[model samples]
Target: MEYRRRTVLRAGTAGIAAAVAGCLGSNSTDDEGSIAGEELALATTTSTYDTGLLDEINAAFQERFGAQVAANAQGTGQAIESARNGNADVILVHARSQEDEFMRNGYGVNRRDLMFNDFVIVGPSDDPAGVSDTEQATAAFEAIADVQAMFVSRGDDSGTHTKEMVIWAEASSEPGGEWYQETGDGMGDTLMIADESNAYTLADRGTFLSMQDNLDLEILLQGPIEGGPELLANPYGIMAINPEIHPNVNYQLAMAYIGFVTSPEGQDVIGNYTSNGQQLFFPEALSDDPNFQQYVPDGWQPNSNGE
Candidate 1:
């Protein structure tokens, strides 16, 4: 929870260059010192950690490997920064562009596809903006802006926040008005704020499912459209901090985590874990099962009274 409290400093021109330099210069064992025990450092987005999926998987991982994992859950941007600063041994996050850049810069290695979920637009059940009927996510966002519907954004450069920005760009809308608000918080807290204020917000399906019973928002848009619009399709990836880049990193344990999450047993656990009778995440790295392929982003069919 302390990870939630740390503010992400503005990554300005000088800050970014310095962060990169730090990553490059800190690879020496003398700089990072040595680990004292069999431990792993995991830095990741709040979505996965907040949904309780990581805790389940981590328990199994601990049981099998006999290693203590210190999970530092934060926004994807901050998690990447933590890796750049040599604070995390491995990372499991969903923001694709950032993840790609992290690897390109030589901070991480052995990136593996772990699982896939989708983002959804959720709002008051009355559908004030009529976003529920929009065929595309962009259209829904446009409508919300057009009607000046209250909207809450994570505003923390999180994975969900990144996806929301992408949708806004696709809609060609720059959403800033009295109706728009930023929580600068995680998914669960953002959802609660949206619920209390009757505002529209984008969320990953896993967190939405996990906290659905406690909120009043309804899913308005989901992914895997009739065509292949990929904005809503959220896929997670796992990677170890390049041990060569930071010698204190537990590369073997990081690899074990990568192996376990992509392994058959790990995949089984992912495929079976559900929230409110719906699967939270689907194992995608090595799975070709039809059951995992079946899903509706809307959370439910239309014209159903909360069935």
Candidate 2:
């Protein structure tokens, strides 16, 4: 089968962010895998969907497997919930902590570390809370709390929201009062809320870059790429819902989707995805070797037989 790669919005510094829904891959005969599993439901994060990464990757995936992907963009936590309820055949999300929990709860299996991108703190250019001066994310959060600076939170238990809470914990400050706010929305929407109110908010680098032109906020502090702390690193994972728990899901298609995304072809599509002349996600599924850690939760003790 011939792979017809779809194009993503690659603007200069100004990003023209829009999701790609065009048909990917050539219109040819359906393969056996495609015929066996024609529909694939994916529950994933808003960052992946809003940034249009899925559309680009799905193009290559369809080209190879011929499965039509229908992604339901939601918070990482909500996405997991959807999988647990048998609504999603597979999931792609960031928030490793949540991913670990999902695996622990026996709702997911065949976990694979897919790709990663770092997070950054974006806020008013004036640096009202002095977050611009902080090198570490924890200090930046403490600064925002000290000054009672306006801060908008996703508060939707999304990957971004989880990372924000972890930073607050490290900062040793309980964010409250009129300063901290919750939008209960996704990354793109929360970023807009912060921009609209001139507030401080933690955002994944890709989403912020894609929506930067429409935002007055500036990237005050960066993630690991800019010598920032490792705390801001955002790693995404792909997992097929456990069929033992829900036999109705298209497990075969789910695994095929996983294989395509983690394969050399999938990794290329992910690595090649860019917005505003910057790469959005760095592929990690194909490391030096097959990482079996994906099969277990983080810090799980390995037995002789491999639990």
Query: Evaluated with TM-score, which candidate comes out highest?
Result: 2
Lowest lDDT 10-residue stretch of candidate 1: 291-300
TM-score of each: 0.81, 0.87
Candidate 1 Cα errors over 4 Å, as ranges: 1-37, 225-229, 287-307
Residue-wise C-alpha lDDT for candidate 1, range 103-128, written one tens digit per residue: 86899887877888888889999999
Q: For model 2, which pairs clash?
A: none
Instruction: Summarize candidate 2's per-residue lDDT along 1-307 as a digit string, tens digits.
Output: 1111222222221110110111222233433333333667889999998898988988777666556888888999888888888788889998888999888888899898998899999999999889889889989988888889999999999999999999988786888999999999989999999999999999999999989989999999999977888999998999988877876776666776787788777899999988889998899998778777777787788799974
Residue 73 alpha-carbon offset, candidate 1, angstroms: 1.0
Q: What would the TM-score be for candidate 1 when compared with the true structure? A: 0.81
Model 2 worst lDDT run, 10 consecutive residues: 13-22
lDDT (CA) per prediction:
0.78, 0.81
